[model samples]
Target chain A: MKRRLFICSFAMATQLFFAATLVLQPARAGSEDAKSSPTEVRVDNFTFSPETLTVPVNNAVTWVNKDDVPHVIASNDGLFKSKALDTDDKYSYTFTKAGSYSYYCSVHPKMVGKIVVQ
Target chain B: MAKNDRFDPSLSGFIEHDHNNDGIDRRGFLKCMAWAGTGALCVIEGGILKSYALGSQKGSAIRSHKTASFSFVQISDSHMGFNKPANPDVIATLKAAVDKINALPDQPDFILHTGDVSHLSKPSEFENVDQILKATNKEIFFVPGEHDVLNDDGAMFRERYGKNSKGQGWYSLDKNGVHFIGLVNVMNLKAGGLGTLGQEQLAWLEDDVRHLTSSTPIVVFAHIPLWTVYPQWGWGTDDSTQALSYLKRFGSVTVLNGHIHQSMQKVEGNITFHTAFSTAFPQPTPGAPEGPGPMKAPAEQLRSVLGITHVNYVQGRHALAVVDSSLV
Candidate 1:
């Protein structure tokens, strides 16, 4: 009986150690992926240039306004409004929820662009 | 005043001299005389004469009369703070527009500003436009161009201009026998550089025109082109097809817009889409280049290129003649 109890305890310890390792591995991998991912978006004349973009959830996206005129990084559902970004100005928003988000420049209605967060 | 009008007292001397100088190689002299005659004529009309000599050609002067017929003046893309080569003083050009409207022999019932009253959506810019427009004696209606709503959640534009407006300042009014619908498409733009009317506004527009008869003259105004002008430059609206779908039933539809800062017109069925020129500057023609920005011209030729659009709506006819006249 004593031998059996010792073995059972050892097995349980090993199982918990492996479970902890499994959980920690994803966290490390996420950090690594973020380091490799592109986080900056360029807002140029009348376009987001890259019409569709994919980024990990919880990762931040920074939009840099490269046009001479002003632009707003606003979500379709009123999720965000970056106000007016002048030339070379920047606005950053993090995606906490995983979903496709669309946005546009409220000033120039025709100037529309979107982003997808996964 | 009647004799001065017909005789053109300023040209009386030149006409008399050219008639008598027949012995001086009349044909060659006529060419030189014509050149000299144009210069002398400028002093009579105004010191600032456009060299294009468009004014020299005698066209029937526009006859203005105050009748019950509905008329409205359209002013778009004022760009008040713009100080670029396309136009140096946008404010001055706008002032000239106001003057031109006031000087019209028959004053319009109202003035409609399609959008882009300010260059950067700044409060000061709005303030400047307000002060200048106040000089006019007619009522002014406005819609936002993307530039005017760039900052402050469009608070500055709404607070100043949206007092009686509905749903982000989008509303419709009945003037004479026409229905005027002002729409907002710049609220939420989409990727691929397309203008959006959003779901809410689209529903409202559908319902707004539901009760009206198909024979009613409908005039829809917005900042972005309702039809595709140049998608590459972000000049076209994404859901414009949805908007135009509703108006397909109308007998006479006119869509007036301003954003591209150039003049272009298209006629589809009963709908006529016209884009106005910017009081600020001119952009490159579609596909002229890979990008869109203020296009500079020779310094002396700038004003002649950047002009205003004049529209005449004749009663008892569906024909609308639009003429774009430069400041020069």
Candidate 2:
């Protein structure tokens, strides 16, 4: 009886360990996905060609200012600020939240662009 | 020759035939002949000869010599470089407007161009506008519209027109007992929103109007509507109240703006706000689903829809009449 009880306890412990591992697998995969997923944006000619962008939550988005003029990648919602990126400069931000983000060039207010994290 | 004769063809024809007649020298006879020929040609051009002659006269018929009465014309949204379907050649339309102003019986004291002188703020675009406006006899005043500040930092506009302007091209001038103020709100536009007059400019504006008496006639010109014309497309100014509050004490305040490419007027107590139609193209009205572009109408209706404004300020009376007339 003692041996049987001990075996039962061991079996329960193994099952609990497996359950915990299963629950933690997705969390680990989420971090790995964030590290691997990189969404790129190109800014050119006083406008962001794809002015409206969409990306998966936890993905990193990069803005490359390919134009001669300087631009600011700033979110109105205060999510990020790429302080005055000059020509050929780049800025990246990891969007961990899911929502629509509207941004504009602080220097040139007429220059506006948006991003959607889902 | 019969004296006091209504039709003495024989006498006149003889005078025409003879190189010298009635002691009028050969050169005098030739001059009279040229004048008579031109008059006859003008008469033949239209049935209403008097009206035609008066129509050829330049400027507004509202005389400026009447002591205590002065007038100026307002033309907005010329959009000179725009070659879209809304207007094939805005320069030609602007020329037509200039001709209209020139044909007025009394020339305006000066002309005010509210904004959007160029479609893209391109150097070539501004240069073209400069050449065309130079033909006009009246002095021109300008303020920057959102479109004109699109590509550059308003360098092209500042270089060309804003010689004596201050603080993002806002300035004030006094003419004919009235004060004129030009404001710059199109520089720093907001997102899915209205234009903005920054804090510094607002402070300056407050101080500028503080000294003026409540009865002073104030003419305020800007690109965006000081009152909310439409908020969805960013047609209104964000801090217009802060600007308007300064002018509220003035008895006669005229607010002029352009951007939506349509004519609209509103009167609030002592203030009268007016928007002039574009000389280029017509945009969709407020809340139209067309997404802020030149709305092409039926070919027959295009000219009637596209129009310009004529502002006449009667001195001492505080009466300003703004008439909108179409190119067609």
Candidate 3:
């Protein structure tokens, strides 16, 4: 009887340890997402959230559109341009060299954003 | 003034931009009144100008009047392949527009597709618009709306619709003594800018009209509003004032534009600026409290702009591939 009770407790402890790891896995991945990609800009209501962002060198930035209307993310100096992003569509660009890059919506030029890589 | 008697100068500044106090509210009211005055047919007889309200009085005057030479129908913003709650089937509405154009007692000489001919600049979208418009059997003239120049920057648009057009799809046609200039203002837009006619296009426009006699009635068509309607909404063109200066010598000038999705009109001196309704959906009129935010359509025939949005995770995706020449 004593042996059986001990075995049951040990099994429950292992199961709890594994379950805790399963729950923590996504949170860990999310933090890593924050660390690696480091930046996210949202296009909403005809404006870019964080209209300006600052990040370290070699970091990637992703612009996700939150508007139903299509928007194109284009750099001012003609360095980079993205395809027309539909609702929930995203375009990612990495900054290997530090610089101040200005961008705007090619479709609606009134919408503008900037990124400063230091 | 009554719809039938629109020529009376008492019409107020309906064709001009609304003042700050009356901007959206009054124009919002006209959206309803437009049902009564869908198209304004005008004729210059002897020395005076006469206007006809198409929907209200079926213009027996135009038929009986011997001076009326030619007429063309304008349909703007087909937005083909747009399947949204606002308008699930844009094809049907375009067909209805064509039907109305054909049903006119005097068959129009041609059709003017003022832009937004496609939803995403997809080949299929352009192809679909082409196949559907064949029912009209009229020579269709086109200008590239911002929507039409997506993807490859209007290369597809120029290839399909701009055969005889020069540089950026601008061209002039002389139809029944009316000099029609289709300008391309939806190109190479700078950050925080309105629609632009580049320096090259401006020079071209200057020379295009230099030789025409002042008596020749001029019709200017473009994708964006040449006159300032709402700068905050990007409803106006940036270099249009310069473009208009070239036309000042002319006695009669008509500017037809499409982009706002709802129709509005203004007459600044002899230049009549008019915007046409979109065939796919209706956007909320500008100057609303919430601002004209990202086509939040609703109101007019189709209330609500028909879209929702959320962020997407790129998941370690690489930077996108881009080309130098796009969005002309």
Candidate that would win on TM-score = 3
lDDT of 3 by residue, B176-201 (tens): 67789999999899899999999999
lDDT of 2 by residue, B1-328 (tens): 1111122122111111111223211221111111111111111000011111112332124222254266677777877666655566778888877776787555678888889887756788788887887777779999998657664657778878898988889999999778899999887555545789989899989999999988678899998889887665567888998999898788778888888777665555556677776777666656655445566655555555556565556666665655555665
| Whole-model Cα lDDT of every candidate shown, in order | 0.65, 0.64, 0.66
Worst 10 residues of 3 chain B by lDDT: B319-328
Arrange candidates by TM-score, highest first: which order?
3, 1, 2
lDDT of 3 by residue, A1-118 (tens): 9996675565455434433332211111122433555578888878899999997654557788776578998899876787788777777665545799999998999999999989
Cα distance off (Å), candidate 3, residue B205: 0.8
What is the C-alpha local distance difference test score of candidate 2? 0.64
Order candidates by lDDT, high to low. 3, 1, 2
Best by lDDT: 3
By TM-score, how accurate is candidate 1? 0.68
DockQ of predictions, in order shown:
0.25, 0.08, 0.42
Q: How would you class the docking of model 3?
A: acceptable
Regions of candidate 1 where Cα sits further than 4 Å from its true position: A1-66, A74-81, A88-118, B1-68
| Chain B TM, every candidate | 0.78, 0.78, 0.76
